[model samples]
Target: FVSMACSSSSFPLMVSISGVRGIACRSITPELIVKYVAAFAYLQITRHQKDLPITEKPEIVLLRDSRVSGEWIERISAGVLQSMGANVLSCGIQPTPTAQLLALQRSNAVGALVITSSHNPKEWNGLKFIDSDGLFLSPESCDVLFQMVNNSAYQYPSFEQRGSFVDFADAAQIHIDTCTSLSYIDLEATKKRNFKVVLDSVNGAGGPIMKSLLETLGCKVIGLNLEPTGVFAHTPEPVPENLGQLCSAVVEHSADFGIAVDPDVDRCVLIDETGKPLGEEYTLALAVKFYLSATEKRGPICKNLSSSRVCDDIAKEYNCISYNTPVGEIHVAKKMVELNAIIGGEGNGGVMLPDVHIGRDALVAATLIVQLLSGFEGTISEYKKSLPQYQIVKLKAPIGNMVPELILADMKKKWEGKEGVTLTEGDGLRIDTSDYWVHMRKSNTEPIIRVIGEHQSEEEARKVCEQFMSEIQNWKAETSE
Candidate 1:
């Protein structure tokens, strides 16, 4: 909640637990990439050397999405790691989840670096750092890396001591094989359904692999923006507003459903058989319902604070525990590991199945959705109707020199002891009521406060979110005065 204004020189370069992102060539330059990569490489080398033999070099897996600048970032990152005496396994044009899986599968790998801005526009690119556990770096680890980057406290090896690089071409196939082999995926049954699906990958890294997965499962795939040309046909985010084409395609093609994934393929959003978006929040909720119903495994479910309450309702139906963490994949993943949760993810169409890997993966979510619908006795829309339904409205407010913590403090006081009101202030201020819940938190990657509210009705959700936004604006005006 600390107010840190961006200087003109670094207007949009965002460094956070989510990783560093900004408009390419402007804020996120080659020099910035080199510094961050070198810092990350140095941190990994130091961390691994503490437990392994000094003679052995740390292996780092490098992957990138299909952004035009991704190749440039990859080359610079690989060279930086190699220069620091870390061997690089370069997996070209793969999704973030694929790189995470590779990092986990490679016994010798010490860490990983993915060059992608995720769902950001094509002009934007950034870096996501993964630890040896195939998870995003924890907040503490990121703090240390940022400190090193700020201080330029990394080392370079001698010419002869520099490490080697290898071009790895098996990442996609390996990821596909692992996903197709999951016990939750009834391959033969899914194939027998012979579902027709429309897939829009936004010409990012998921196109070829997602198409391949559906075809392997015997699905007739209608592909759009599948060329990985780094030129997005529309806004890259797979939200309802950005997915009109996918929705229309689903209805136009008489498909069973439509699927859209972000640039790095970690988020999955779906359109129903009738060409209606199922809402990004339902992605995780549907996955939770399917996992709990389809398997004998009964454990806790974890999601971010901003996720839908329907997930909790689904867990309650199964007599399972549900935990809510701060808004980040690492937090949810760590909580899942601690609780041995069956599944966890963010509400932004990210689904993390521990059985697959502890990362939000579109591939995993898509597979689960396909299987869930294939086994259901009705259409995709009907199946959605069967699940617990909720409406969520998400809006952003500009900070404008107003401190987020101060705004949250006022909100906490305003609702501290109201009837059935509960306030959570760990990551941000979240006010929970019997009917709906509203969360206001600072954006990790943008200079704004995200105000999210969910209720059984869409109008109520929008009203609650707008109320908070109006209050924030009032506070900003007062601050200006």
Candidate 2:
């Protein structure tokens, strides 16, 4: 019998197409980073070898957020890729989506690696892999790559065959230029507004890029945590509760609105002119309104099942169709690709525009929101009030030792015949009714089951969430007993 101790059991490491995430130096050590980065490069070389030209060397773009551990991870990644005979294009401390966009521009690029943990705590840092097409890897690709990592199947070239490195520091400029040149962005109109705006990047990757983009649009910027020092001003998620400083700053500066991005700058949340957060969900909702209104081609809009139904409402208003997949930005992105969705994203401030890269882009979201505001007659608060109002209550409970399958089955039986109730079980259990919907899913990044309920009224949403929370608590207690 063999007994092996695991030192990282307490700090769980998560591996998915999104990337590997865990506590730095614990589950996500330098050694692990090198292994995974090598695995990624190997998979790309192996899978895409036939498509490559013999004379062209496979190139990869590497980027990182402002997390303190990012530089060390970047060094390990660069070493692994170079050792494996791939050319590296290093775009230091850029937004997650910027890495993806830059990948598409490289003719010989096979993939890109972004070192970021998004909204995770300061202690956590990770990587997100972008394919040559500038999209996150699909589940099938991820599965194959994981097998390679497990088997330690990676190539190490001879000294003479080692790859070369190039400093590609202009990713931020490329992103801004691309966003500004998009037909939807009213550059002249945005500039004429001369809008005063406050930006809080949480000392992550978004600060410089967002400031540059907003300034180009002629907004007077009052920036907070503009330095990408990795020392976060507060909790880094950009949720309403975590954005009190931004809210206060918005009012203090008399800015038109305040924008906040998570550590990696993919998700964007907004604070209104009146010092009220528009909620992360509104970021996508308003962008949908703008994008759909501007585009002539009417197509289906894609969103995750757990995303706000406001997306559906907007699509319906445009006389377009709306479709949903399971949770995760990749799911939404893939669905958008399949359906050729003109606009879509998750409720957590992710805006996926096929016109810009397929990944969730906070920069794109901010640009689109400003375009929407440019044509509007009132403040963001008033504009928000014009839309359909839905209250979403989110809660999480520890999974403990309970079997999620049994709990889901029980939930299905209990709500099976109830009028106006519908059940879904793919990504955990989701119960939908005419006016309210509740989705309970085991979090991919955390050890808890997230319960979310949305209704037209705050009271009803709260009630629905509480009911489900209580049920889960009861079931967990019974299982432990």
Best candidate (score: lDDT): 1
Q: Poorest 10 consecutive residues of model 1 by lDDT?
A: 1-10
Q: Record all residue pairs in model 1 with backbone atoms less than 3 Å apart, i.e. clashing.
A: none
Model 1: CA > 4 A from native:
1-5, 50-55
Residue lDDT tens for model 1, 454-481: 9999999999999999999999999989
Cα lDDT computed for each candidate against the true fold: 0.89, 0.86
- Report residue 404 deviation for candidate 1 (angstroms): 1.2
Cα RMSD, each candidate: 1.6, 2.9
| Per-residue C-alpha lDDT of model 2 across residues 428-471, encoded as one tens digit per residue | 88899999999987776655788999999989999999999999
Top-TM-score candidate index: 1
Evaluate residue 294 in candidate 2 and report its C-alpha lDDT on the 0 to 100 scale: 83
